[model samples]
Each structure stands twice: as structure tokens, then as C-alpha cells.
Target chain A: MSSGEIKALVFDVFGTVVDWRTSISRQAAEFGAKHGVTADWDKFADDWRAGYGAGMAKVNSGEDEWKIVDQIHRERLEVILDEYGFPNINDDELTEFNKAWHRLDGWPDATTGLTRLKSKFIISSLSNGNIALLTNMAKYANLPWDAVLSAELAGKYKRHPRAYTKTAELLGLEYDEVMLVAAHNDDLRGAIKAGLKAALVTRPDEFGDAKKPDLEPDPDFNYFAKDFHDLADQLGCD
Target chain B: MSSGEIKALVFDVFGTVVDWRTSISRQAAEFGAKHGVTADWDKFADDWRAGYGAGMAKVNSGEDEWKIVDQIHRERLEVILDEYGFPNINDDELTEFNKAWHRLDGWPDATTGLTRLKSKFIISSLSNGNIALLTNMAKYANLPWDAVLSAELAGKYKRHPRAYTKTAELLGLEYDEVMLVAAHNDDLRGAIKAGLKAALVTRPDEFGDAKKPDLEPDPDFNYFAKDFHDLADQLGCD
Candidate 1:
């Protein structure tokens, strides 16, 4: 009911806590230059991310076998590399580059804001990203998570109730005791539908200037704020 | 083959990171005084821990349903409490007392040593303890873990190959790239048998004066040290 009842804040990491678009675009541009190629890296970032939803959909629909986000991202990266006019990159180089997702930078307010929230509640990542990606990004970006949880643990991706429910089970908390703090309204709605509380922390720049951000929360959402700092403030976290 | 090859250091928490024996004994003594009951609290702690291995063996052997370590601990606590002649405890009090495991203090070298190790290697809790137990303990004791991994994730307890192999898989690292740093020789041997490198970091007083400690490492272990600090130095962590 109230934000005070929330024992934990499980975050959606990719576009919510970290600016995956900008980070991926920057890395893609550098990779392009190294191969003497040029293209819209922003579009490339979008295209790369486009595969994510579709990839998860296939698994959730039972049309494909269970595969982790890292594998999905790698599969997409291989296809995109060939399309972007790159030479045949060796397996080692591809493997290293595939970890660009692991090197993502958190939004400016992420570290300090999460620290403030951590003082008042157990904070963790509930991203669809695999544990390795979330773990590496936490270290790389200085994101202070008490635990790095993933849909990988549930053997399903988000929007699937199992992912949300399994996380609560793992943390030994009731569904309503955990709140999903995410920038995307869809993710928050998924949490609400799955019996967990929802907080929409807007990142208007999450999709960059081209796409319209979900700036306002739906009426049913428990809390709406501008960013992690705003959410911490609203939750009465010092 | 060497500590140099290790990318991640997964720790065995119970006896290695925390002085659980003393912590549990102190808590038990306090609870007993409140209830007008008395016993050798040290023995109580030992008796409480005694159920852990056998309980896990049942689950690992498919003789019992899978349960987290917290549930396992609670079951043991209930049996011990009755034996200690305690009166009826309300559900809330029993729940609070069961969380004594969560409030454990890190060994003298744990926090500082883990921080130093975290500087160079990805460090995590690879305990048979459940996710909630490990996460709460990390926060309570100021253990700076990059992530928390557990046997609960694999639905098997330590010395089970699945537990060790799944941890490496979750981290996206080769088995040899992740080393198990444990106070127990058998756990280190489990890591080795599962293809991971092993570090025997002794806790000479882990079981207190009544029990023999694992003071020596098997020759096959990749590294050996007296405590976490010594282990950090041997592993070239600053």
C-alpha cells in the first residue's frame, strides 16, 4: 500500500539504471572506426536492443529453448557486425566485444542515489540481464547493489510472472514486500500484475531524443519520480 | 593452475567469513536468559549447525524436498529450542531469533581483506546459505561482495558438482577462472573436482577450542594462507 511497506527495491537495470543506448552507441562507433566503417551508431544501438525483446518473446512463447541474455546479445551482435560492414572478427575479439554490455555506465545519479536507498532498504538488480553482465556492470559502474538478481535465476525473462515471483521467493519476501523500480511503465505494470508493488522512476533520456519517454506514471502505480534520487527522497531515504 | 588465472574468488561464508559459532552462541545465551532457561550455548550453536549438513544431504540426495538454508536453520532451531526447555515462542520471536545467522559479525580480517581482494578480483559468496541469508549477512557485516552466488541457485549443496559448475556458468567464466576460497578442505576439494582452482584459507579457530581446525591444505590446492588477508596477499590483491 504505502512505500514504507516495501522491504526491498528490485531495479530494472538496462535502460532504467544505466544508459545502455549511449554506452552501446559509443562503443559501436569505436568498433566501426577500427574497421574503417561508418554508420549511425545510435540506430545500431537501437537495432541491437530490438533483438532483445523479440529474443525473449521466443523463449517465453516456448518457440525456442531457454537462452540467457548474454547469448541473445551475442547472437544479435554477430548479425549486426556482419551488416555493419565489418571484417570477420575472431572468436576472442567477438567474445570481448560482446561484453560491452558488461561495461555499461550507470546514469549519473545511479550510484549515490542507490546508496541512499540502500540505507533504508535492500536494493538489488532485477534486470533481464544475466548475472555476469549485472555483476560486471555493478563493478564497472560503481552501482551499489546489495544483491545482483536476474531473470536468469528464474529461467525466464521479465514480463513473465515467474521472474518477478522467483526473485521475491529467493529473497524470502512476500511479493508485495518487494517493489520494482523501473523507468519503463510496462515493466512496472508487469510487477503490479504479478502482485509486487511498482514505482516508476522516469529516465526521460533513456531512449534518447528520438523516442518519447514514459514521463508520467499510470494512475495505479504506487510512486512516480524523476530518477533514483527522487525515488529515494519519496521513499524517505536519507 | 595458478591464482594468476583466477578472475573471480568465490568464498565459503559460514566458518570462513563470519565467526558464526560465537555469534550464535551469544544470541542463544541472551534468548535463554529471557526465557528463564540455561544451557551450554556453545553446544547449542554446534547442535544447531549439526542439522545443516544432514538436512542438506537429504535434499541433495532427493530424500527431502529442496529448501533454503534459512528454512534448514529454522528447523534445526526449533528442535534445539525444545531440547533447551524454552517455553512456547511466538512466530515473530522465532522468526527474529532464526535470523541470528543474518546478524553474524565478520571475522577480524573479513571486511578489509575482502575489500582488498575486490580491488582486483570479482568476489562473491558461494555458500550453501540461501540468497537472502548471504545478502543480509553481507550488508550486516559490511562484506564487500561484487555479487552473491549460492548453492540454492543450483538446488544442491556444497561438494555437489552442480553447485560449483553452475556458479562458474553464472559468472560466464571457465571453471579454472574462478577459485573457491574456503576454510574447509573438503569444500576446496569439491571445487577442484569440479574443475575450479582452490584456495585454502584457514580459520584456525572456526570451531572454537573443542574441535580440530583445518590447519593444512592439500598439496593440490592452488594457494594456501592463514586468513583472508594472507590469502589476498598470496593472490596479489592490494
Candidate 2:
């Protein structure tokens, strides 16, 4: 498909747009130094992220009450700090440190490609991150979004049909008119399942040697590209 | 109050940031000329807006089911068109005409002043208009909103206390830390009653001689400025 009918591009922000692993690892290293603690910051970033899926699953499965990603991150942070043998950090410092997620730096092509896309179509974040997280990150990273939408608005996490469909509904577009751009095959597949168009943008460095990444698009995906700039060019974004 | 604690400034878009009356009237004039019709487009704009309160009131009072501002505007447009003696316009034409609300022009201080305030505080649109309308308007008017929030998110209309509080909650802020910057006293008061701080930014020409503008802030308002630039100045934005 030419993607001519696509009116909005809703992005998966975490690994697709921002280099979260490097960003988080860098921030965590400074945070560790402040507390006189040392460990593998990269693993710390990964371990913190490991709790994200299970945390959302608990809410999606009705095992726990509804909570924002910030809350989930904070709860997981407490466990990670204890496991890493960190000293007693006060609540204020912990609260400030938790906002490291909001201060992420975008991938090299993110802001420029999004600016080009914005000239032609609406661009927004369709992430599991809550509204506050997305808004703060947009400012911190200079991702110019026309809207900051989240799965939090749908009361579901990514891969949930409602999350994809609800984002389309909120943007006042038909499901197919809002394309989901992500680095993960599963997420693109989920968007296709929800009747939305899907574009697979490869982020080979997303895992940074920690694990293999989804460099190939699924058969059902509408478009496949190496980065956002390639996706923007294929989509005819000037 | 120093206004130093305020983290985000949520705006009332229609009249505060944009001169909707002039924008609608101008668009209506162009539309009327194409249809071989002529009338006081300003009055036509006013007549069209008269349905807004009743439309939102029906939903807020649970008399009618929820509807987006686009639907409400279209419903109101049909009546005004018939009243103005326009010929039977086709569904496609009417649908296109209905988007006039999304094409509003911002007031002179809007873009530049908002850019200034955005440097120091998170700026957002917290309007009764639906997310689609706000998003479209932001792109058209060049309003720099960090988040396009709306009363629709709360499932309530303006003047509803829940609308104010829910906006603050979504921003991950306490009510007192998110100030509502509006030209209308009633909207500012609504935000105040919901435990938010209120800033009254006078828009003296908002009504365009149709009605008196609110040049004076309520005694309880935390700040009053002549325009967004003044508000930015008072708040110590560089």
C-alpha cells in the first residue's frame, strides 16, 4: 500500500524513537555515583525495564489495581535498588531520579524525521508510557508531537487491541488511517490485528548486544525501513 | 502567590489563545460566497456558537449521549445553515464546512508568547473542545502545546469540577501545581473550585463588540496578565 490514506502516525516511543538503554544507563551511572554505589548500569537499566511488562500484565489481568507507568517504574525501582545493594536513598531523591525516564534523548533521526512527517501528517506518541511521561519526554527530547496520547488513556497496555483501536478513535480517524510505527514485530502485528496500518522501523541497536532485535518486519506489515528517516521517505513525507 | 510552584499551564483555547469569532466569521464568509449567499457572517458565527452550550449541557446533564465537539458543531451547523436561508448543501460540503472550527487563527501573542512560556512551564490546551479539534487547531494556528488535553478526557464538560482535577491528575501534578490560564472568569473559577490555581489573561477583543470581555480577574485568581507574554513575564520565563 502507498500509505496515501494514512493521516496520522502514532509511534512506539521506548526503543523505536529514544535510545532508552543508553539514556537510562548514563543517567543511572550518575545516580549511582551520587549514592556511592557501583554496578553494571546497563544491566540495571535492563532489569528496571524487565518489570514493566509484568507490571502492566498484572493490571491487564485484573490482578492489581490500575496504575500509571511512573508508579510501576517506581515500584520496580525499589526492588532493583535493594537487589543492587544501594544505600538508603531518601524519597525526594528517589522521586527525582525516577524522572530519568522523562529525560531520555531521542535517536539521531527521530526529531528531524518527525519534523518532516509533521509537515505532511499528524505525529503523536502511542506508547504504554503515561501522558505525563510522554509530554515530559517530548519536551526533554524535542519530539514535536501534535498530540501526546498513551495506552494509559485506553486503560490497557500495548498489544491490547483496545490500545490500538482507542488511539485511532481518539485521533478521530478510522483504524486503518492511523498507522503504528514501531521497531518490534509483535507491536506492528498487534496494530494490524486491531485493523490499523503497521510500519516496521528497524532499530538494530535497540538491545545493544544484550539481546537480538527485530530487524525484519513481519509478512503482514505494510512498510519496512531501517530507521525513521527511511520510513518518512517511503511514506512520502517531505 | 509567586507562581513558582506551577509546573504546567493549561489553556482555554477558543477565545483565550484564539480569536474564534473572527476566524469563524471569516471562514463562513468564504463558504457563503461559494454558495451565492451573503449575510452578516459575524452574526452567523454567533448564531452557530449559541448551540454549543446547549449541546454540551445535554451531555453534561446526561440528557443526550456523549458527542465530540466535531459532531456537536456539525449538528449545530445544520440548523444555522437552514436559518440563514442557504440551499440544501450536500453531506460532503457540510462535512467540509464543519471543519471551519479547526482552522482558527491564533491571537497575535499566541505563538511567540506561548513559545516563551513553554520554555519554563509545560504548556497545554485544556479546552472543552475534543482532542481532534484541539490537535487540528494547534497545527493550523501554530499553537505550541506540549499536550492536547480536553474535558472530553474526563467525560465531563467545562464548569464541571472533575474536568479541572482530572487534567491535573493526567499531568501527574497536584491540582494546585497546574494553573488554568483562561480569559473567561467562569472557566478560571471552575479550575479554582477544583483546587487548581487560576490565572486570568484578559482578551479584551475576544467578543469583538458582540459582548463585553472579561478585563478584570476575579479576586481569588492567582495571576492576571494582559496577554500570554505578560503572563510569561510575571512567571519569570526567559
Candidate 3:
């Protein structure tokens, strides 16, 4: 299938469009310092995010009740804060700190690239994040989204077929007419399995410079680009 | 309640944010000219809209199955086209013409007013218009919406408690924290009945010069203004 057939581009927000690890790490560091604690904040960020997939898996597999990404993050954060040898923090302060995820700065190209992509096709967030989180993040980062769609609406998380398929249906498009754009190979694969086209946009710094990145695309992937700007160009969008 | 307690301002799109009469009449005139027909396009526009509320009522009341606003408009269009003596047109052209609702122009104060309001509160489209219609209209008219929450998502049409309450629920806010900004008194009353604050933003020209407008505000409404700009000023938005 050609890119011309793609009517909408649904994006994965966390590490694909926004540098979550770095953003989370910085905020984690500040919160730690305030509590007179110090630890590998990068590791703290990683540890917090590490539970995301497993948390969603529990819900998708029916082992746990449905909970939004914010709730998932908060549950993991409480455990991590104690692990870091921090003093007890008040619930209000912790709630504010948990919203650090909402304040992430987008990759430099995210805003402009999305603007160009929006000029040609409908662009929206197809994140595991809930609507409130995505809406807050868009304002925080100046992300230009045509609509803020979430797995919360489907009561399931990403990699679950329902999330991707439901988003396409909500946008009034056929599954094949919607393309999932993400930095993760597993996510693209999930979208493909769900009968949606996939584009792998590399974000080498997503996991920080030390770790190897998924720089190469799988054979079945529809498109691979260095970043959102490159993806826009490849898709023939101005 | 004070404006300070209103965390989000949800707009009623059709006659509130957009000048639907003008936009529909303009498009209808062009379609008539193409078909060698002449009629009062304003009356045609009015006739087209007169069915919208009743169409939705049928679904909300379970008298008819669920249908999006676009489908509702198309259903009414068929009846009116016959009355206007429109010659037989192909399905594709009819479908395109039905999208006249999607190409609506925002009121003169819409874009700028919404931008101002966005600085102080979350601004979203809380219309009965389906997600696709609202999304496309936002792009066509340059509406800066943080999210698009529709009655379709709630499986009910406006004036139904589900439509108003569900929108606040989706935005992750309490009913009282979300204010419904609308030109029609009944819609605002529905919102108030659902425990949400109401703002009556009058659009005197919404029905055109011949008819009376909803210029008076209900005594219980939290705020009243002449337009979106006036609403923004009343809300203390920069």
C-alpha cells in the first residue's frame, strides 16, 4: 500500500514524540533534591516507565481492573520513591510531581513536523495515556494535535488491537486508512497486526545515549525515517 | 459559582462557535447554481437545520438507532433536495455536498476568542456533532481545540444528561468544574441540570436578521456575554 492511501497519522507520544526519559529524569532529580534524597534519577525514570507495559498487560489480560496511565504511573511512583530512600512526601506534592509526565518537552521537531503533517492529513495522539494526560501534555509542549484520543476511551492499552482499531473507528476511517507512527518496533508491529499501516520514526535518544536504539525497521514495516520531519518528507507532506 | 471554579469551557459548536446559517446558505447557493435552480438559500439553510434537533431526539429517545450528525444531515438533505427540485445526483457528489456541515466557517471572534480562553482554561468542542465532523471543521476553520468530546461518544444527543455529564467525565473533571458555553437557552439549561455551570454567549445574528435571537440569559446562568470575545472578557481570559 502507498502512503497516499493513509488518511490519518496516529502517534505514540511517550518516547516517540516526547523525550520522556530525559524529561522524567530531570523532574525526578528535582523532586529527589527537595526531599533530601539522591539517586540515579535516570534509573528512577527508567524504573517508573518499566512498569508501564506490565501494568497494561495486567488490564488487557483481565488480571487487573482497568486503570488509566496516570493511575499506573502513580502506583509505580509510590514504590519507587521509597526505594530511593526518600522521606515521606505529602499526597498533594506527590500528585503534582506525578504530573511531571504531563510537562514533558517534545523533541525539537515534534511541533513543526506535526504542523506540516497536519496540513496534509488528520494527526492525533493514539497514546496509552488517558485523555486528560494527553490534553495537558499537548498544552505543556505545544503539540499540535487535531484530536486527543486515548486507550482510556477503549478501556485498554496500546499493543491491544482494541486501542488502535477503536481509534480508527472513532476517527470515522477504516483500519487500513489509519497509520500508526511510533519509535518502538513492538508498537509498530502491534499496529500492523491490527491491520493498520505502521511507520517507524527513530528516536535514538529515547533510551539515552548508552543503550542501543532500534535504528533499523522490520522488513514488514511500511516506512522508516530518522525523525518526524523526515517522516513528513517521506510521506510527501509539506 | 465564580468563573474561578470553572476549569474548562466546553463549547456548543453549531450556532455558538460557527455561523452555520451563513456557511450553509453559501454552500447551498453554489449547489443550486450548479443544478440550474434558484431559491431562497437562507430558507434552505433553515430548513436543513430544523431537522437536526428532532433527528437527534429520535436517537436519544430510542425511537431510532444511533446515527452521527453527518448521517442525520444527509437524511434531511434527501428530503430537502427533492423539495428544491434538485436533479438526480450521484452518491459521491451527494456525499460531498452533505459535507457542507464539515466546511463551516467559525464566527469572526471564534479563533481569536478561543485562543484567549485557552490561556486560562481547557477549551474543547462539546458538540453533538460527531468526532469526524468536529475534527474536520476544526482544521477547515482553524479552531484551536485542546480536545474534541462529542455526544456520539456518550451515545446520546445534547439536552440529554448523558451528553453534558459524559463530556465533563471524559475531560477528567467534576461536572461543576466544566462550564457549557452556548447560545441556546435550552442547551445551557440541560448543562445546568447535569450539574455543570452555564455561560450564555449570545449570537444575535445566529438566526439571521429576520428572526428573533436568544439574547436574554436565564437568571441562573453563571455568565452572559454578546459573543465569544465578550465571554472571554467576562471570564478574565487574557
What residue pairs are clashing in model 2? none
On residues A90-152, what C-alpha lDDT tens digit does candidate 1 reach at each position?
988888888999999999999999999999999999999999999999999999899999999
Best by DockQ: 2
Assess the local accuracy of residue A105 in candidate 1 as a C-alpha lDDT between 0 and 100: 91
- What are the per-model DockQ values? 0.89, 0.89, 0.81
Candidate 3 regions exceeding 4 Å error are A1-4, A209-211, B1-4, B209-211
If ranked by lDDT, best first, what sequence of candidates would result? 2, 1, 3
Consecutive 10-residue window with the lowest summed lDDT within model 3 chain B? B1-10
**What's the true lDDT of residue A107 in model 3?**
96
Q: What tens digits encode model 3's per-residue C-alpha lDDT throughout A1-238?
A: 2334899999999989899999999999998888889898898999999888889999999999999888899999999888888888888788889999899999999999999999899999999998888999999999999999988888888889899999988887889999999999999999999989999999989888546768899999999999888998998997
lDDT tens per residue, model 1, B11-50: 9999999999999999999999999998999999999999
True contacts kept of each: 0.81, 0.84, 0.81
What is the TM-score of candidate 3?
A: 0.95
TM-score of each: 0.98, 0.97, 0.95
List where candidate 1 sits over 4 angstroms from the true fold.
Answer: A1-4, B1-4
For every candidate structure, what is the RMSD over all alpha carbons to the true structure, in angstroms? 1.8, 1.9, 2.2
Cα displacement (Å) at residue B179, model 3? 1.3
* Candidate scoring better on DockQ of 2 and 3: 2
* Alpha carbon lDDT at A145, candidate 3: 96
